[model samples]
Target: LPHRYPFLLIDRIIELDIPNLKVKALKNVTVNEEFFNGHFPEYPVMPGVLIIEAMAQAGAYLMIKKLKAEGADGDFTVLFAGIDSAKFRKPVRPGDQIIFEIEGLNIKKSMGKIKGVAKVDGQVVCEAVLMAALKKS
Candidate 1:
């Protein structure tokens, strides 16, 4: 990803199925996070928007990896075009590890749509449908 520390929410790509257009990634939430300090110094719950961002990052990873496998060339970056049906079911806090599962719903040319779900301890915390555009950087 083009993100750096404190912004790059994805910690690892645990699974990738290129042919299936699916990916699974992890993000370990910690009290040391900068957002935690401002989001809530006392309670420290992870922001809902960041969870959605994490899902988007996972989807971006899947698209990038697929492009690589297909021998596509270009310094590309994925940018959010839209987010739909986003729902936050539970709060995420320090010491929680979020697992993002993203599946491509439609991908053609520069536009793509993906369904993403964020889970902690096998329970869904958030889910959304993300739309993005792949642009050459």
Candidate 2:
């Protein structure tokens, strides 16, 4: 979603409900990830920040897609506006697949807020409230 490899975290979108403003996306973790090299050489764990970024990206994607589906007239870019109540509940390692479940909390002409949960094996690993704004691309 407008993101290049290594920086783009979403691998696939499993479910989407644009009207409800909810989506479920996946990211497969692997040793090949560049962050694994220095995040922890001996005992690698996916960085918490990256997980949060993944959540934000998923939220942004949702905004972009919904706007497109609504036939927005201009080229718009979704930008991360804020993050709140971010929590890391567990460590993410290689072989783990993060299921990002995001629900829109509020959306407006320019700004939007969404709540996201990152899960691994049905257990939540991280959660946050993310905000974004629409801007000229």
Per-residue C-alpha lDDT of model 1 across residues 6-32, encoded as one tens digit per residue: 689999999999999999999999888
The worst-scoring run of ten residues by lDDT in candidate 1 lies at 67-76
lDDT of each: 0.92, 0.90
Q: Where does candidate 1 stray beyond 4 Å? A: none
TM-score of each: 0.96, 0.95
Q: Show pairs that collide, candidate 2.
A: none
Candidate 2 residue lDDT tens string, 46-118: 9999999999888887887778778777777788888899999999999999999999888666888999999
The prediction achieving the highest lDDT against the true structure is: 1
Off by over 4 Å in 2: none
